[model samples]
Target chain A: MLGVLGGMGPLASAEFMRRLTLLTPAERDQDHIPAVLWSDPRVPDRTAARLGGGEDPLPALLRGIRGLEAAGCGAIAIPCNTVHGWFEAMQAATPLPILHIVDAAAAELARLGVPRGRIGVMGTAGTLAMRLYQQRLEGRGYECLVPTETEMARLVTPGIAEVKANRVAEAHAPLAESARALAARGARAVVLGCTEIPLGIAAGPPLPFPVCDTIDALARAAIGWARGA
Target chain B: MLGVLGGMGPLASAEFMRRLTLLTPAERDQDHIPAVLWSDPRVPDRTAARLGGGEDPLPALLRGIRGLEAAGCGAIAIPCNTVHGWFEAMQAATPLPILHIVDAAAAELARLGVPRGRIGVMGTAGTLAMRLYQQRLEGRGYECLVPTETEMARLVTPGIAEVKANRVAEAHAPLAESARALAARGARAVVLGCTEIPLGIAAGPPLPFPVCDTIDALARAAIGWARGA
Candidate 1:
């Protein structure tokens, strides 16, 4: 059973669990995988940790991992994309394999055979500030693009906050426009690096190329891993 | 895969899912049952439907069940206790067998050999107002007890609302007192009929006997059914 270490924002955790459910192929109650979720919202903020403005999230995260491990969880998956800044440390904290969201997204990109594609990334300012995905994608020979400061404040910030506020409809138009601009800049696909983006944006019409929703991609990857694909 | 027809209250839905995750015993990701959850807070109030005060919830409920069924959910479970009042109509609305929280609770009581015992039930004013559990338990030869109007308003109401608001810490004392009174009234076990109740009052010291957490019981049943045991 995979243990979900979540509450990086409760909605993201909920989405990850919903994705797991939707991806499972079953005709009845008897056909589904078990999951243990430790969704303690009390954990220190990931952005705060990344910005070095608050307490480290690693200790609380380690406590969660230990709780799941003691509860007999097999592999662990963290839905928060940015917590991966301390991914290596968090992984070392638990004996269970911590499934890297970045690696999973990168693997999906590789399998789609968009070799050396330019990918647009949208996430928390902290996530962008770290250039985590940019580094990871560039390491795999792909270019990663992000919105500029003004656009980040206008599009990404409101989009994520809207999701956090459960007001997705209000943020939809701006996100669509942002994705369109990214596609115009030669990005093959837009990676909704923020877990909250999928909750708001509808990318198909405004964006010329496909918007590879990282949440959907992560869900698909989880399904494949569960099915031993 | 199990489809959860929930979001009558977000916290209630979350607690039900937590119970399911905690109950399943699996060593690997593929070893557990998968779940699809449709938590449409948009579903009309069940109390309103019962009292003929508002639009029927069946339409919105059908939408939730259909979403999960279309996604290939094998069995459907509705987490909200009060919503089970519309179970017959909901079943008529879909081809799938949507499990009833009432039936699951009754069955657990029967299995525990406390079939005719005095059971204290705690739920929303709407659920208690419906007497869904009272009727079901009476049909199965059990005596059911609900809190008086004063107790309902002072204890059950705020306790349930605290859970819905995610103010679980604030709910503890009020629920503990209620548990004691119910046990004092010769109740053998307290039935946490409302999903929110389980989140706030799962294992309190004041209860005379086992607190038959219906959400946990339903989840255990779901897990058992999922494992084909």
Candidate 2:
């Protein structure tokens, strides 16, 4: 059974579960993967703590992992990209494999037939600060494009914030604007690196450029692991 | 924090979480109600046991209840209507308040401005057998309309089974046929008592008669409790 360590923002985790069920090749409830979602929204803001003086979210993350472990979960998946900044520490604390969102997104990019050229990465400021997607995807031989500080402040950040506030339709303009900007600058594809960004993007029109949704990517990864792929 | 005792068929529980999120009048992630979904799909079939020659789900249910209590959930909501047959026994085993699905459905019927005429109740055989909704709705001065054994065996049962198997589109026809029959028989409104029914209903055309989705009703009740309504 998979353990979903979520509520890093509840909507994303729930979306992952919804996507998991959709993506699975199952004929019945019994054929579907059995999982537990330890969705404690009380876990302190991951991006805040990583960016500066917010309280540490490590203890809470570990508690979720241990709780799922106690519940007999064979593996774990945390749907938030910003929180993956703590991935190493969290993984070190548990024996179970925590599916890596960056790896999942990279694999999804490949599956989408995105050439190994340029990829845009959009996420919470903390995810960019930690260079989460860039570092790993770059290692996979793809050059990364990111939002400028002005673009981040003016469009991406506020767009993600609106999604967190449930103003999904309002979030699209700014997020799409940023993604379009990245595409104009030669980005082959844009990674909706933050979980919130995908919700924001889905709120409005489809992007002209090929794009990868990390939530779906991570969900596919979790499904793969569950199905022993 | 709200504890969702789900996975009485994983899809329904996940839908409950989705409905809970959508119904909440929140402007941001923090403003949404905090919840943990203990979605263990391993619990034995409720309908099978009630009809005889099947394993009892009590011990598994009790484990889930205690697990939620230990996780510091302030209240509990079980989304599956059929499992509510064990409501008293489960509630007796926990200090945390378990929200009643029938009461929530009754209140929703009132909120929707349905008159005190015949209200249809559709659910798993166990829920009907245990009189989970029938007796309670009857007490509220509402005439209860249930599917005949033929309707249950032919339409309702197979439709629900398809939903459990994630064949939502296929489930729609039989389920809709059942609802139309109920409305033709003078049902003022139908309470989609089974969690899976609403999903099936949503897949196809909308019902002419007013309908109350127990999942949404139950979610509203959870929100009410969380917000002190």
Top-DockQ candidate index: 2
Per-model chain B TM-scores are 0.91, 0.97
Cα lDDT for residue B57, candidate 1: 78
Q: Write the per-residue lDDT of candidate 1 for residues A52-115, one digit (tens) a residue.
A: 6888888878877776676566787787787888888987777888777877788667666665
Q: Model 1, residue A44: what's the lDDT?
A: 72
| Location of the lowest summed lDDT over 10 successive residues in candidate 1 chain A | A26-35
Q: Tens digit of lDDT per residue, candidate 1, span B31-119?
A: 33556555555577676677767778788778666666665667888888888888888888788777778878877776666777688
Q: Estimate each model's TM-score.
A: 0.54, 0.94
Worst 10 residues of 2 chain A by lDDT: A22-31
- Alpha-carbon shift of residue A148 in model 1 (angstroms): 0.4
Model 2 agreement with the true structure over B1-229: per-residue lDDT tens digits: 8988988778888888878877887766667777778887778889888988589999999988877777778999999898888888998899899999988998899888984788788999988888888677776688888899999999999999988888889999999999999889998899999998998999998888889999999999999999983
Error of 2 at B89 (Å): 1.9
Candidate 1: regions farther than 4 A off: A111-113, A202-207, B1-229
Candidate 1's iRMSD: 15.3
Could you give the fnat of all candidates in order?
0.00, 0.47
CAPRI tier for the interface of model 1: incorrect
lDDT of 2 at A115: 52
